[model samples]
Target: MYKVIRKILFLLPPEEAHYVSLFLLQLICSTPFTRKLLRNFFEPVKVSPITIAGIHFRNPVGLAAGFDKNALHLRELSCLGFGHVEIGTVTPQPQRGNERPRLFRLPADNALINRMGFNNDGVVTIAKRLKYWREEVQPYVDLEKPLIIGGNIGKNKSTSNEEAWRDYEFCFERLHPWVDYFVVNVSSPNTPGLRALQDRSFLEKILTGLQKKNQEMKNPKPIFLKIAPDLEWIQVDEVIELVLAIGLDGLVVSNTTIRRDALLTPPNTVSRMGAGGLSGAPLKERNTSLLAYIHKKTNGKIPLIASGGIFTATDATEKFKAGASLVQVWTGFVYEGPAIAKNISAASPV
Candidate 1:
């Protein structure tokens, strides 16, 4: 059914297709009857719940960050049966991201290349939306379990690296009350100098500041770091060491990769897509390996949420086998249609 729908959607531009599809879903979900019908049709079979960093996830499959950048579609997205929906790589202030044509599809490779540059409605606005979801919409959603919400926060592209910690701090404070967990995003390749925050000195300052603020809250949310898959092993070691030392809650295992090697997409075609993080099937092995490395290096002390190339039960099971406590899907959700979470959860052991 989605294959036929996808063909129609594929005719439009990738970014255009994204919103058009979601808008249609949101329209269907606007009514209580249709919403409940959609929920029943798409909801995953009940699986034993799992807890990580003190948050309960009804299933391991979640929609990754960048899907609902502004917290606009939580009610509609919840009906699709994701155990969690991570919103934002939100900045302290809203900014129009890089130019259009920033998001591209690599259908031959089952991949997407995006240089979205954290284009979002910013922290304050998104937080308000989240608060509304919790206070108004969540209660009426006919689901057996609550959908977990994660805030994936980042600095504005204009923010200097020296002052980047402050940006992260600002976002964390605003979003703390609303999101179930927070993912510090220093890994996105689209934002200029953003990835530099992953350096030990810079990263430590940001994580420690956020942690300090977190502790001050009566009920602190879990803090996780999202890293790029292109990192060298030494860089991974630095990240693992910092995470263990700071008592950070977990790692998201990966963001998208800047590397474009080994793709089925033609070189000229991929080059034309240009300068965005690459994600999807091309990412699975490296991300899985990174998860395993972190799991072994931390001796399983740090919980991990696998993201990247997960599109099916087998992909998800691979993540679980590599010690991921949870998994997130962005490109997979786009490529696999609405049943992605349900399909993966139904077959995954975790």
Candidate 2:
């Protein structure tokens, strides 16, 4: 079973283990016979195709943006049965994220803390790769299957808040043609003061700028805002208001939380890990609260993509019960492995 294998995988540094697994997955998925064999291990569900922003999702479970920062693994990721795979916290310029040991694992809690600092291959590279994905990679998969692709955009670490909108705009304009939807990421804790962009005034500038350009295009992609679960209720209220006023397509209810309160992991060990957003089992309750709050604030007018610590069918279903139209996974995928997406989709509300 995966538990035993996971124990061995856990023996390696978290970051290296991730790549090792990714490499193995890509290898298995590259061949038809092996891909089908792996597919059988994932239980299928009666997917209720949900329509949002005029796009159809065969199911509601999606891969969160941080996992595949560029589009490199879209085919491999989508083959695992996620209804969508959001790629990138991509910036205008590529940068090596934080230095060595930026990712840490809390095995006892089934969680990860990362100061990846938007480490990515950049928007131009990602966009170019995406063009090939849409043109070539996707066609080989099951037909008209998952929503399959999204671009999650953010600013470079070196960029100032005043010029931050330009970074987002750059990614937005370039990636629009290939991705199904756009998630504006301003909530990550790793980037210096990136969370400050969640401010109403600053967020308005970014969203408004994107929307203006979106309208000018003959084909406008659906755009949603991704927010941090660290937000207070008043801040959540402001975000809900902004989404409504800006006519933004939707909101990704919550990102990783900065709060380390009451975790089973000892404070000193956690503190030693240094600065980064925390995601996994500990995030479930607060994540649900924020999603339910956002749904209540908008009176369910805005579609929500619930994400935080989901690692099981029940956790993802709770997001739906709290009113998410879709859900995404990062920590959950790490914990549950390939079965994660299918498990949640099968448990989705009828």
Candidate 3:
């Protein structure tokens, strides 16, 4: 059914199609009758519990950060059956992202390239909505064992690289209470000069600042770093060092890659879609290798939340065998539709 719907959705502009699909989810999951009925469409199957940092997730498959920029779909998304849903990459203030045509679909290769530069309603607005979820919806959703929520934080576009840590600090303080864990996103290609924060010195400083605040908190949540798949080998080594030096809780094995190679889509089509992060099947090998490499360097000391081209159960299994404690889905969810979480988990080693 989703594949058929995907065929129809594919015809529309990718951005429009995204909104439409979310609308349908909101529409169905909002109604009590529809919500109950739709539950049957998504069957829940227990794989195994995954413990990372200090919390336990029902399954290893999670929806990656960019999918739900704000916490708007918390209720609806949980209904789609993801073990966890990461929201944000949200900034200090809301900003209309780059011009449209920012999201492009490459169906030929089951991938997507997006330059949707941290487009979100900022932290304040998102906090208000999040408060409602945290206060009202989340409690009722089962606090004893509620669905996991991760806050993926990033700085605003206007912030200079020198003052960037302030932006991350601002967001960390605000989202600290609501989210279950944190992913410090400094690797997005869409944001100008943002990737520069990946530098070992700067990244250590940023994580150290956040870690200090977390330690002071009455309740400190797990904070992880999200790095770019485009990093050079030396850069990866720097990251491994940073993770160990800071004692960061974990690492999300990637954001997206800027390098576009072996894409089934023609160069002309890709060139027209210019300037965005490439994610999907093209990312599977690199993402898996990254996890393996990081595991080897860290000696399996740091936890890893693998993200990249997870289109099927096989792709997910590779991540698990490679050393990922958990896995996140982005391009797969877009191309494979809602059953993806269940589909992947059903066949995973976990």
Best-matching candidate per lDDT? 1
lDDT by residue (233-320, candidate 3, tens digit) is 9999988888888889999999889999999899999999999899989999999999999998878999999999998899999999
Write candidate 2's Cα lDDT for 17-87 as tens digits.
Answer: 99999998898888888777766666356667688898888778888988988888877776777788889
By lDDT, the better pick of 2 and 3 is 3
Q: For candidate 2, what is the TM-score? A: 0.97
Best by TM-score: 1
Off by over 4 Å in 3: 142-144
TM-score of each: 0.99, 0.97, 0.97
lDDT of 1 by residue, 1-350 (tens): 99999999999999999999999998898898998798889889856589999999988999999999999999888889888999998899998999999999999999999999888998988999989888988877834589999999999988899999999999999999899999999999999988888999999999999999999999999999999999999999998999999999999979999999999989999999889999999999999999998998878999999998999999999999999999999999888999998899999996
Ranking by TM-score: 1, 3, 2
What lDDT would each prediction earn against the true structure? 0.92, 0.87, 0.89
Candidate 1 achieves a global lDDT of 0.92
Q: lDDT, candidate 1, residue 260?
A: 90
- Candidate 2 lowest-lDDT run of ten: 38-47
